[model samples]
Target chain A: MTSRRAFLQRSGLIGLGFVAADALATSERLLAAVPGLDPGDPEVPNEEVARILKDLFGDRPIRKGHLTLDMPVVAEDGRIVPVIIESDLPMTPEHYVKAVHLIVDHNPDPHLAAYHLTPAIGSVAIQTRIKMKRTTWVRAIVDTSGGDVWAAYAHVNVSLNGCG
Target chain B: MAIGEARIRIPDRITRGDLITVNAIVMHPMDTGFFRTAEGKPIPAFFIRDVVVTYGGEQVARFEWTSGVSKDPVVSFTLKADKEAPLAITWTDTKGGVYRQTADIAFTAA
Candidate 1:
């Protein structure tokens, strides 16, 4: 005897709850990996990165925008495999790009590189070479207008890992 | 600057659908930690670990690497076709300094 309106409301509540749980899970996962990363450059904790990012913004995670990752799951040549990131969001001076972080999973330590972009960079695009330890996920987290964090994941299959 | 000779090869032109392979090599000593100086001092980590290449002022390729690359670093990638554009290469030192250079890829009948 539940009304359709009541069912819709319940479903909406469930959706909201799921989203909250998902966000929590993502943050936890990020934090969990923070300790093991002895990157040698500097042991940059995930929290410090979060803090830096928060200080830049109003203490909010970047918004998820329309983003695409261009890379193959398996690379024929590990020394250099092609990779690219393309965001569908409009690139303009008024509401333009901020930065892009490259997360290469195959490497012993992730958080491979960061590209600080401006309107002059045009569309916040970046391409780079990353040494893969094994089969790994390459993620591109982009910060754009509205403080959104749009990310795209790419699984790189490497037959010849450049790290070797 | 241990090696002076390097090679760069880019296909004629790139368009939306066309995929082209780009190749580059930089001559340098990829000194891994396995070696030591005459006094047995572990040479500080000095390697080109990061590389960025842009086309037509838009970034087209990038690389993250370590000293494991080899004595000399050679990087190659593929990209879609575009009009006449310049491919810029910037090699980043371990401590984060950049050695910037550019290459022009011309759109010609291939």
Candidate 2:
């Protein structure tokens, strides 16, 4: 364990130790509370999103607004589903987007990615392609530096599943 | 080291307060490390972890990503333009590879 910690430290990922430890603690606590939870699965269950939200924001409610998630109504390939997320929030120092998250409803791993942001980003828009396991709802959530959370969602119809 | 391509799109004639869309794609395998080669050896994971776009020496957008992104990653976003400027995009990969591309925008009287 010390060697692993040293390796991670040498890799310059020491700042991520808190997040890694939090995720591990959250998963362990969740497994103890939920029955039949698979330990091998890396994807956070859809039901666990609430727990994650609670963990991230204690008692702060997340509202569905202020974001536009552009996604294809029907995706020809599940391997590549293009998505664009734009936020209407101001990028001023007082109110800037801090982070964004991509979540899939039915994938083995629901939490696809998390993006940290800074005020240097003048616009709160992002575009990328994500792999979908099947036809499911995908969501984009944004957290602003001013302590506000906004989100939007879209449904993609996939012809075939792609994630393992 | 691999070569990456990027493109910036704006109206032929830029007027103040016009929204300009920029699209960029990088040539990368984006190996997820979940697949095995024919010899059954697992391929190491390497992908672009961060991409940043700058215009007029100011950052316009930035993206933080992971292996979940598709191969040959493409990103598009819009910026409200007030003046003509050169746009630059830089991508940093997980394997310590840095790629950059730039394009200039010409403003026409509107």
Candidate 3:
């Protein structure tokens, strides 16, 4: 066994050399008390995603450039995938955007995540991260004037996402 | 039910004419009611239903959604901006809960 002082330096956890050699045991106990974050599964498909848009914005045409989406081509860790969106329109009281909706197509509840904005916003840009259980697309649905809908999307490959 | 924190990050230096990138993150339980309790019972689904974004108090984006999202949702966007404003995001749940965050950064001029 290493000397008491040496043990502390070896185990980067800090504050233990003074305790009995069972320090390792104590560490386990401390760690166990900490709660873990577990985000559940992602199970959405592209087709279903389209249906969602159609159902939500009835008879509204979704234009192409009102929104833009950015996502990593591949996410090694399923718990966090980067996503971004931006829109071109004055966010003034008279002409600003109304809201931005974010959708992940592989989660158990594929219909997760949404945002609402008022004229307080001068631009239409937002960035966020999400979890993915499998390969999926991050879809953005935007609401413009005359009740028209515009969309943007990005495909992200999740290696093995799920509740941690 | 867990309270979640959402954060936004953006480029400090951006062209006065090009769009800038914005990144955001939220800390949430996204408790999909489908979950089972420790007692092996199904937990009711609870998650964010919609979100909106604004820059300089001007409306920019909005959406409506169901439970197809992963937990602790993170989203990103591109904004064509000038040097005077920041972006803000807000989320709402069907259960009457709200989550919001903001980011102040440089944006290209229109």
Winning model by DockQ: 2
In model 2, the runs with Cα more than 4 Å from the true position are A1-58, A72-76, A90-96, A105-111, A114-125, A157-159, B1-3
What tens-digit string does per-residue lDDT give for candidate 2 at B1-110?
Answer: 35555455555666766666667788887776766889999888887888887878887666777666788887766666665778788889987889888877667676
For residues A25-125, what per-residue lDDT tens digits would candidate 3 score against the true structure?
55344333321201121222344554565456655545556677878898888766666677776666666566566767656656555666555444676
lDDT of 2 by residue, A39-135 (tens): 5433333456645555555555556789998999998887798888988888767888888888776765566777666664557677888877788
Error of 2 at B49 (Å): 0.4
Ranking by lDDT: 2, 3, 1
Q: Which of the two candidates, 1 or 3, achieves a greater lDDT against the reference?
A: 3
Candidate 1 chain A least-lDDT 10 residues = A36-45
Provide interface RMSD per model, one decimal.
6.5, 2.9, 4.9
Among all candidates shown, the one with the greatest TM-score: 2
**Candidate 2 TM-score over all chains jointly:** 0.70
* Displacement of the residue B57 alpha carbon in candidate 3, Å: 12
